[model samples]
Target: MSTVQDYASRLSDPGSRKMGTFSYLPPMSPQQIRKQIDWIVQNGWNPAIEHVEPQHAMHSYWYMWKLPMFGETDIDLVLAELEACHRANPGNHVRLIGYDNFSQSQGANMVIYRGRAV
Candidate 1:
């Protein structure tokens, strides 16, 4: 088995990972996360949450958390749901998605939580 140092070394290698958008950004504070939710609401983007084991994070499909929050404008509500998802599936990689209804595709996708050290 690869030791933590080995895993860390691999992760440290440039181009070793090609994950979601937020994965590139520094971990967001709760306030920052709230702002992101607000941006989603302001743009009228449909919000959804999905999660998967860290090892399977590169897989295309992740288990959805309940359903998409359609027509949801309350940032607090979205934050609460994200918290619930993380609590329910502790140590799972969690992501937030913003689907564009007009384009019928995902407009924004980002990793909100990355689970590891299991």
Candidate 2:
């Protein structure tokens, strides 16, 4: 059996991790995320926001901020909601998720927006 120290030695350093669309890259700025959201909206995908504790990096689930924004195209509203979620869950890892079923058939796209540690 692997000891806690053994696991700790095998684990990579704690830091922001990449997921979906822009994996293997640095975290995107708010403006960059806004552009991606806009593009997804233009492509007819619904947007949703979710977050997770940084320490729970390997966990498969995240807490949803609000229901998916179906048919909503205004970027400001999304940005506002994202900001609110960040404020409410400071030090957590927030994400913007998009879903499209008709055009691309892909159900999800995700991007991380790391929150400042309080």
Candidate 3:
């Protein structure tokens, strides 16, 4: 039988990576950012960039209202579209906003923006 340590090791092995996205609702505070980071770590999703490192490749912030109000249905597709949009735009970092999943869908469903922070 496998020991608890074995399972724990598997979960913590950064090599076991999962891709997920984040988008922030407007009016969010620093505390909210901490909460979000905690959620990500707890979920075992490893970000491509370190949270504290300057010039991280995939750091972002998203405003809720900027998201598309309707038309598109699938969250994944929306995320892909938003990512593509960001790729087209010039920027150092991108934050997905309004990428929400309402129906208990798993994984990332955030709408984000990509640009250099001022």
> lDDT (CA) for every model shown?
0.81, 0.72, 0.36
RMSD, candidate 1, Å: 6.9
- Indicate which candidate wins on TM-score: 1
Q: Which ten residues in a row have the lowest lDDT in candidate 3?
A: 46-55
Which structure is stronger by lDDT: 1 or 3? 1
lDDT leader: 1
My TM-score estimates for the predictions, one after another, are 0.82, 0.74, 0.28
| Segments of candidate 2 deviating more than 4 angstroms | 1-12, 21-23, 103-108, 116-118
Q: Rank the candidates by lDDT, best first.
A: 1, 2, 3
Clashing pairs in model 1? none
Give Cα distance to truth, residue 19, candidate 3, Å: 16
- Candidate 1 lDDT tens digits, 61-107: 89999999999998888888988999999888788899888899998
Worst 10 residues of 1 by lDDT: 6-15
